[model samples]
Target: MTSAQVEKGSEHTSEEGYERGLGSRQVQMIAIGGAIGVGLFLNAGANIAKAGPSLILMYAVAGVIIFFIMRALGELLLYRPVSGSFAEYSREFLGPFFGYFTGWTYWLLWVVTGMAELTAAAIYIHYWFPDVPQWASALGFLVVLFVANLISVKLFGEIEFWFSMIKVTALIGMIVIGLGVLTFGFSAAGDTAAVSNLWAFDGFFPKGIGSSLMTLQGVMFAYLAVELVGVTAGESENPEKTLPKAINTLPWRIGLFYVGALTVILCVVKWTEFAPGVSPFVKAFAMIGIPAGAGIVNFVVLTAALSSCNSGMYSTGRMLRTLADSGEAPKAFNKLSVTKTPALAITVSVLFMGIGVVLNYIVPEKAFGYVVSVATAAGIWTWLMILISHVRYRRAVEAGRLPASSFPAPGGSKGSYVAIVFLLFVTGLIAYDSESRVCLYVMAGWAVALGIGWAVLKARNPQIAERREPEFEKV
Candidate 1:
């Protein structure tokens, strides 16, 4: 296959209707913003408590796996940049059923993730307004973000750019302040703040290697939306340049935001001092005696939650539209509004995300935990599909059946295989942990449901069930 053939094959599909409103800056920020969300803001404290300083090692390992997965995705994106992303590759490489499953599962992933974010946002709001109902706060945020998404893709990009900017800026500030405490002993925690705090209490692996391994599930959850960058290919101003740059910077982002920030915080305030159900950054600030520091951190986390939920609305709409164009979902989702946005799809997805508000009402205490587990399960499936599809694409390229991706992943198919095994290991850990095991059960039910839906779609339109050859193969 020649470069001409690859370029021809990369032409827009059903995603052509989208406006290329997301610029390089917005895409870059989106990639950065997606990596820092409620998972790190509110959930890391629990992980730290469970793994001690070993949590840093777990994050580093998971970050490497995530980097491998993104490289695989980056190769495919450069091959065929589309809003459908992994779902499109899955259909071409795996089969139509796999594509359908990946599309709907990804859609399901963000919906539940939005629920978890809303739950977290409500919790953050409680720090400022303790008397307010969690459900009410969740509903308010849901409506605001829903409106922002309905307007236009450009608006969505701007909102996400600022949301992510706040998160990145606050995290950098936190790390700097943490360093100050450790270096000069300028704050209240200064005397106690030292690098030795990591191993001083109960050693680095305080709860044993088994307990530290259990935290991988949550760590992977924190990295869930990092692939959202792939979904923006159709809307990006320049997919080839912007997508690769976005993916290449992922390692450093993970290093600084997750590993570096956590190391600094744990150094200042011992892993044991951090508790579940609280933001470790907030706790570190409070311990350092920064006046109103906890309040400021709470506000930052609230934005983080909203940012993820906003992204959920954006990606779910696009995924639903992709499924609709492929005849796997309702046709109504195939239409775009005057602004060239998937208005109906966005509306339907937001309505489902409202289930989070109901969960907050009925199970406020458990809403965050329940939704996070389910989101992580769905996310694992999506990442596996990307890795598997990449492996298949590489095989096709090696066999002279398809042209190679311009941005080929390092180690070719080997990185994908490693990432796949790592994901499966995380899945096994999910099953081994009693609390997170419920997510696997939930995913089982979800699979059965998607299977039934596919059978009905197949019965209605046999063409939708047929596995088509890749466009390059047809040439």
Candidate 2:
């Protein structure tokens, strides 16, 4: 058979393998789990303070961008269902350097994100134990998450499903109570606060467009995890069927969980009065004298942080395995356990995450921003690579070099460019904001590291060097 025929057949082999790993339900919840983060539970108040009632508009706009990007990703995933998904696509469609940079950067993002999640877990634990050391709590959670990941993929999925379910249930409950207070006038502690706090202040956009723009930083990062679904494509039981099913829900998940929840919060409480120190959902319920709102949300946020950390470990492991597969990372990361899980990668990633415990104790005040900025910087790089890779993929298709895809990105090459430009704008905005300036610095340092890596790899591999040599042949 010709080389082309072998390439075509390998596609089928990859799909069959993925089908054995991921199911429909796991795929759906994984997407949901990624989008729902501490940002929703803890950071909502910060957004409110920044944009006031306009925070809703910020989420809505960011949601649209996220939705389209997912669609573009969905199209790419359908055509080439591999273990690394986008990272693999970046290598084949863009180049080896692009792939290496994308995969490692994404891995770095997950590692830093794991750190943030563990740190958040520790701080939340502080609510219950005023005297307990933050480092101790962070360390304890890291150990627990590591063990959970050592099991098979199916087991990991089960744990994440339940963990995410707790948070989802809490948010739904809050929304319900909030609406009840708004419409039927529920009484709490024999006192009633009017529900018109949503608009009773200075109207939506009270913070002006400037604040609304700045709030995008949080919303963007909050939605960063949603793409975790793409990584699961390699492990999914049926990539063709399951992937599309999962991608289709991106809009609904964002709307119901993000937009819906935020709308409820604004409607029940005045945006100006929203405080980051308190859970708006809990405070709203407390306004109606509902008992245990704080405790309930506290427990839920704890679980949410745990789930995010859980996913962080799992995703970073998978990315490491992918890198190893593509000759970008160490060989050990590619080794799988009896459960077909990357055990070594999981262990190493968790070890790095344990630093969160140390940082929590050593520098509790600086830990949050440090973790977030690093994650955001890596996220920008990953998205940029994805868009660039898709652009190349579509060009090959249009030039009749590649087979007609089973699924195609809407608007074809044009859509990819649009997403790329929009993402770049967001990256620029993040850089301009003083709050996100650290992210810029972190990414700059990361790019330099990637450059050094590429240079070393080139010096060692003549074949790679040849590939990097640009051809002068005319298109």
Candidate 3:
């Protein structure tokens, strides 16, 4: 790489190493697009069915906790911005082993998340091409997005920008059309859009808090990519200004996209009508007799799946590079393309994600459920590691061992403490679930596997212990 490549993607920038190819608009939209994914577009129907209309409240509550989590992460980013972000922070504060584990766990999380999303993508494709096999759909989307990420980060940002715009537009349209039907009785939904539908069936907590809590596993999964903003910090132009701007808008996005959209959905179609496999967005439009409802929602959900796979490729590539720089992964995984994209790392991750396609052939019926449960556990592990590292970071600051963060976490360590407990409660709820008990099994297996891998790497590369982080952007 040339010195200019390190300094900036364009002549107007100053970061020395990374392309800094992602403009502020791209970063802002990437944050928005990241927060809204297949979880909301696809898995949400199942959650609403479990919790009834009260799922709105559940999502709002989860949003608040997630906000706190983001705040802690935001503070960390301003402390020291790097593509490796949390993995570096975890290494610096928690321990090398914990950092190594966090990077791989995040990598694993997105691998499965991509798989789970492709599982949903297959179903969406089936909407248009009924005769095509699910595996074919999964493979097709995987290849397309893999090629996209290979081109350049700028191209990736462009793709994500439009992907996010589609999601935001879909949600806004739903809300407006839903309200019109509710107040003016304009649509063919026939008074089905009334807000009273939230309670008309069997009251707000139709299935009780137990059922709602049981769905927390998936609910938390919907919030999985909310921290992706941190991942983009390294490549982002003007991160000092753009990073905070992106992170600050999250609360509104959560309220508007998740809480508001779902509330509008339940208002349009009673909870009883929403089935586990159905997209509530499609169902809402169909209720109003919109002829292209299914097709429109299918397109949106398809983009959501692709968007997730796109992000999965992006994050895993960066993380593998981090692990490689840290001497935890194969050094070749760190190689970048001419466009400065981690082509090798991204291609490797995409190849692994295609496992989802193969699994569809082997067990088409239960693939999404099983893989999603595993992804949920992996997501929780990543978040837990982030919090643990942040706690340690807070202590170091308080003790004057490290300088105070430019953007300190709100409520300081107390917020992290509360968020940790909340995450544990959600994990406990997953264990309590008979269907989701497999997540615990998966987590145990992953831990053992990662431990074994670490041992092997340590023996193979003892020099890694003596290695220092490269002064340039190692990510």
TM-score of each: 0.97, 0.91, 0.95
Which pairs of residues have clashing backbones in candidate 1? none
Candidate 1 error regions (>4 Å): 1-15, 473-475
Give the C-alpha miss distance for residue 437 in model 3, angstroms: 1.4
Query: How far does residue 119 in candidate 3 sit from its true spot (Å)?
Result: 1.2
Best by lDDT: 1
lDDT of 2 by residue, 1-475 (tens): 1224324434433332322444678777887777888777777777788788778778888888777777778877766666686777777777788888888888888888888878777767877797988888888888887888887788888888888778777888877877777777665522333545556677677767887888777777788788888888767766677778778888888888889988877776667667764556656555556667776777888888889888988888988888886667888888888777889998988888777777888898778668887787788678777777777767877897765556676777676677677778777888898877887887888889889988987787646633231111121
Clash count for candidate 2 is 8
TM match of model 3 to true structure? 0.95
Tens-digit lDDT track for model 3 on 1-475? 2333433543443342457789999899989988888888888989988999888988898898898888889888877777888888878777777888889989998999999989999988888788999998898889999999999889999999999899889878878888778878876885666888999999999999889878878888999998888998778876777888998999999999999999888887889999888788877787888779768878998898888888999999989888887889898987777788778889889889989999988998788998899988988887887788789879978998666766788889888889899999998888888889988998898899989988898799776544244233354
Cα-based lDDT for every prediction: 0.93, 0.75, 0.84
CA error at residue 221 for candidate 3, angstroms = 0.5
**Better-scoring candidate (lDDT), 2 or 3:** 3
Q: What is the Cα-based lDDT of residue 250 in candidate 3?
A: 93
Q: What is the lDDT of candidate 1?
A: 0.93
Q: How do these models rank on TM-score, best leading?
A: 1, 3, 2
Q: Residue-wise lDDT of candidate 1 within 1-475, one digit each (tens)?
A: 3445434434542236788888899999999999999999999999998999999999999999999999999999988788999999999989999999999999999999999999999999988899999999999999999999999999999999999999999999999988988899998999999999889988999999999999999999999999999999888877878999999999999999999999999999988888999999888898899999999999999999999999999999999999998999999999999998999999999999999999999999999999999999999999999999999999988998777888999999999999999999999999998999999999999999999999999899999988866555655
Candidate 2: residue 378 Cα off by (Å): 1.2
Q: Report the lDDT of model 1 for residue 197.
A: 89
